[model samples]
Target chain A: MRRPISLALAGLLLSASGAAAGPERVAFPAGYQDGFVRYLDVDRPDRKIKRLFYVNPAALETAKAGDPLPDGTVLIMEDHPVELDGEAPRRDAEGRFIATPEVTNVFVMEKQPGWGEAYPADTRNGDWDYAWFDAAGTLKHSDPERYAGCFNCHQSRAGRDFTFTFFKYVEDLKR
Target chain B: MGRCLALAILFSGLASAGQAAEITVGMAAADYTPATVEARVGDRLVFLNDDSVDHNVFVPTAGHAVDLGKQVPGARSELPLGKAGAFEVECVIHPDMHLQVRVVR
Candidate 1:
């Protein structure tokens, strides 16, 4: 009886395809409420900041939006390190923090990508190292080169509260 | 109390020390290397500008995104790993130049 049952089981196994687990969906932790990064021309002596904008993750939906972003939105920008003197805390006409040219990149922590989880704090340990987009809304590998472009831009904000231009989003912070 | 304070100080130092790791990812003929890397929590990735042109890096995610902006030859850029999971790095100017980095807690 045991031999007959064993034979039947083996036959069933042979007929079946190896069960392969589906792709793992990663859940990034939640993102910040709303913020924008400011880029400064650190290369100059006066620490002249080029511009300031709000980073609105929602804008991804309308990359071609014409009007200014809604409240509680963030703006993203990219640039290189600028030469300047001591840690000058400069603010723009809008009262936002000015980022130095050394600030190569900028980002806003308003929304999380639907595919992945919010960045895990314990993982990268407070470093803005990389960028990604869940194009397919799946946690699988996306384009790396595209992501690298994003990283290089954000590297300049390593210091200054680990943020490039959070001061610009003063209204967002109040929320 | 003294012992507790000392332990707190030590822990704070370790937490804020910002431990970093050097990783090379890019194409040889291309202007980048290692394009992407996987690291544990509390690690860092160093991008060395091996190419003649300048390169910028940034992320588009919440809380963990950055922009290295641009760098010239022989200049090195550093990024801190603040979270777990996969992130992308790219060059804004040379859209073709790209890389990926993964951090695990």
Candidate 2:
């Protein structure tokens, strides 16, 4: 079930396990989405962001409604800006924005049994860690401070296992 | 009608506005006081961070999402709730600090 790790993420993880603890624990999803299932789509304003949310099969199988996601769950968010005419997006007859096939940004969130042990309580998302990548699946940040925000931001969702969308994924699995 | 179409009609157009008020949220002890709030659309949220370290305010709920990134201690930010829905707000830096907002017409 383990795939080849991204070289950049692997290098960071090597460092994290030794001394510098950070999001190095997270790996860029293989093929940007291998072994992940797309569960939800969100449309934003202005830019018409059509976000495709993918969750690891482990999460789908083990998750229960209104409960925390199982450990080792990996969630990937892929941003596909809607096709636009001028500043407004062109829609089909149903008035739904059409998302471009090209992904603009990707965010990865993963949870393990002891991943948060290196972080302090204030910045730990339980055992979850976050990493960001560009369309080409290249890690875009190397600063420790940058990863700190990921933990801090997701802290609010502690009641939901520190995730904003895992419940929706569980709901999707039900259907 | 489909669920999406029903929701589209529900959230579309200007949310009803009779009286708009400001709600204050205090961040201290690495937590948001009154973690759950029930308010009306067109209301404004003011966040005051009194925690020792820096905190943040981010809402990624579709049309109303806002990111007041990297808010230092003693900082304040305002967010206008323009839509009627249930959404979650987080400091992003702290796991225990979260705010649940339910805005109704």
Candidate 3:
């Protein structure tokens, strides 16, 4: 009788554990590349979310001139989900989704001069970098002073994301 | 046998007695608060999501990287630094956010 009771208890525990498990895998579709760019909120540090952007270079250049987003870009406002511990997720606010911190990163993927087709590349090996755009959609990369200020901050993330801290979105490519 | 039981109880009590000290580092607007942190080798650093959006904390070099993948507002994360050295801390979601950790021996 005791043995039967113990077995039942064990089975119950196993079921509970299975129910609590998260998704087995997350998939990012092919034909697109993903990365992120970070910026400091000008207002206050205590109340901002780092902006995360997912991009597809193939659709770029075709975008209308002066559009806030480059072509082939899907800007998902993601925040760290408390329940998932370290995973980043998109959040919905009111009718639309707004990423906390209210900032946007501007990235352009220009083809390197000598690279031929069949070159294996992703965010890490891609010939892309970023510039910060203000709320008004002005590009800040051309300013020499701005470049240093931005590059210095991003230098830390160079190894992980070719960025400062936005590499968490590429969960599949992490080494 | 009674002596052994008492020792076991005492050991268990000790194990549960002390809560580790938790320090929260906030990443916002592209910077790490308490950017220069000083702590003993075994101390824990808790990265909090006080900002309105998500942030990712990771180390690029040879150290423990806790990819606090994406933290939403009012959330928090914790990572233990067991080795003593300077670890570069940054948010992967924000390429420009940076923080430095000075782990002392």
TM-score of 2: 0.57
Error of 3 at B13 (Å): 26
Clashes of each: 83, 6, 20
Return whichever of 2 and 3 wins on TM-score.
2
Query: Just chain B of model 3: what TM-score?
Result: 0.73
Task: Give the runs in model 2 whose Cα sits over 4 Å from its true position.
Answer: A1-20, A32-34, A171-175, B1-105
The candidate that achieves the highest TM-score relative to the unseen native structure: 2
Each candidate structure's TM-score, on Cα atoms with residue i matched to residue i, is 0.36, 0.57, 0.36
CA-based DockQ, model 1:
0.04
Candidate 3: tens digits of C-alpha lDDT, residues A1-175: 4432332232233121232111111112222223333211111113223333344433232333322223223322223212111343322221111344433444332222221111112211222223344344454344323333333443444554233322333331232
- The full ranking of all candidates by lDDT, starting with the best, is 2, 3, 1
Q: Write the per-residue lDDT of candidate 2 for residues A1-175, one digit (tens) a residue.
A: 1111222232244233353345555778776366787766655543467777888887788888777788889888888888888997665443346788898888888877767665555555676767788888778785546665566556666777877666644654463
Where's the lowest-lDDT run of ten residues in candidate 1 chain A? A20-29
DockQ of each: 0.04, 0.13, 0.02
CAPRI grade, predicted model 1 = incorrect
For residue A69, give model 3's deviation from the true position in Å: 28
Q: Between prediction 1 and prediction 3, which has the larger DockQ?
A: 1
Better of 2 and 3 by lDDT: 2
